[model samples]
Target: MRRPQLLHLGGRPRQHAEREPRHRRFCRSSVALTVGLLLTGCAGGVEPGDAASPGPAALPEGVAVEIVQLRADVAVRQAQVHIVNGSDADLEIGDVAVDDPRFVAPATRVLPGRTSRVPAGGEVDIRVQLPDVACARDDVEPSEPTVALGFTVDGAAGTARVTADDPLGFLAPLHERECRAAALAEAATLAFTGFMPAPTGEPARLELTVTPTGGGSATLVAVQATNLLDFGPATVDGAFPLDVTVAPDDIAPIVVDIPILPSRCDPHAVQEDKRGTIFDVRLTLAGDPGEIELFVGDALRGDILTWVSSWCGFAGTP
Candidate 1:
């Protein structure tokens, strides 16, 4: 396993955010009815000799397609598929999907309010909700990930299953992130149990609960920083070191009171929050190092957000 590390998003652009899970919508196109069912409500390939069928055009042999998994915001489960049209002709695309051995099921791209069209020399990026990680072994990299690209050529609709490229190699890290989280889950469940609002400029103690799953003994390494929150051993200097251990025989949960403070003073900081309430925690079990993200419940998150605004004296004062 890779060394346990925190996931920092302070430097990441705020434009990258996954607001919510996109719903499946239909695309109006005439296609082979038999293949339409497999596309998750999208139209399928059209028959060869249909009079209404436009002659389908084939994508270039080497189309630039890759998965963009931006590990920012709450859209950690969402990914984007970028397909660059290398062909000279403009193709009207339908459903786009990516298949990888590391994932249990293929993820279809989601274009909330945009059309799936690939103009010549241009690219189209559609969001996709990643399926459950298939962690059968330690090495979870998919050897040859593929994409099922549905497109219209000369008005003819067809689906092409081609080898998808990972130029930036986003899959390996994704695999690591999910599989590591899974491993940590099997060992224990970590959460921000509770928090009470403190006066402005005063330190607040947030409770972190670690409930072991009796699978193995694990050690909490550290709690990583978030955009609007800071944590530490006693104060918000970011020096919190949780070397606490939870063995399998330990029946009761281990509770730790974490000192936290609002790291930002700008009103937009809370207004444009994405992962402000999430806490990235690193851990170690036996010799394997792993990292997991813990989140507070909705009520607690709201409470914390309100506290931040009050502490920072934002639009909504406390």
Candidate 2:
């Protein structure tokens, strides 16, 4: 993946203003901010009867199972499960069950064409809502044994068992959960979007938005800024770069307006050169554990528009 270059807002003067009350609706109070990430499926087919397969031999004769995404951290709260049909005939999954009391597989159902297919692959989302009883009462040591997965195929005599690999494989869901939690923690806070030259030709303006998770507060104190002009011909810097404060419950659009003049060098291409003068604003923030998530938007002459994203967690938690 290519990393987008962020502009530095340093050396460009800024004008600060208070956030309006009407624009304060994006920040919700105490709702779960689910950061959904689609896990990519592996290439080719999962080998039948492999350790990663979800079914045991000499039991139910039906669809085969494959574990795609496993993690040790469960903070992310959700996971994606994949299964590939390896039988000569169509196979059916009656239901999926987790024997472990601590693990909860919320979503378990065969997709339409993907299910009951020969040499076909399918997936289901496994949500982890570890009960307080398990999280609080369970003192299971790291070296202790774990449970297996029970799969009841359609019209099967008995349930098949998929013994989970102790430690690493069994706790795979937890790891993904933690990563998502870290992302939510980072995302539900303040992040700097960077500075851009305002149309009014004043000090360069810095634009950023703050998103909040239901827990804790964060403050953005701008300590340093760096300016770069390698991408385009224009350059802008902050005159007096200082700390900027962002309240936790405040999910508002903060714009620091500044004054900047375009520098043109060519004679015949002066207007085009002036338009190309682009300076990237890069800012350093002093705040809680989180990252700066980047969102890029493109417009094609007002006819078509699109947006892309790459997250940069602030405070290093993401």
Kindly give the number of clashing pairs for every candidate.
2, 44
Query: Which ten contiguous residues of candidate 2 have the minimum total lDDT?
Result: 301-310
Candidate 2, 1-318: lDDT as tens digits: 001112111111111122123112211210111010011111122235455544323322222333322221122222223332323332343334333434333233222212222222222222223322133224643321121233334433223444322312534334333333344454354333544543322334444444555454444333222221121213323322323444445565455433233222222222112112222222332343332212222121011000000011112110
lDDT at 78 for candidate 1? Answer: 67
Cα deviation of 113 in candidate 1 (Å)? 12
Alpha-carbon TM-score of each model against the true structure: 0.72, 0.32
Residues 9-82, candidate 1, lDDT per residue (tens digit)?
21111111221121011111111211322333233234456436554334543245555554342345666665
Q: Give the Å error, residue 272, model 1.
A: 2.4
Q: What overall lDDT goes with each candidate model?
A: 0.62, 0.29
Candidate 1 global CA lDDT score: 0.62
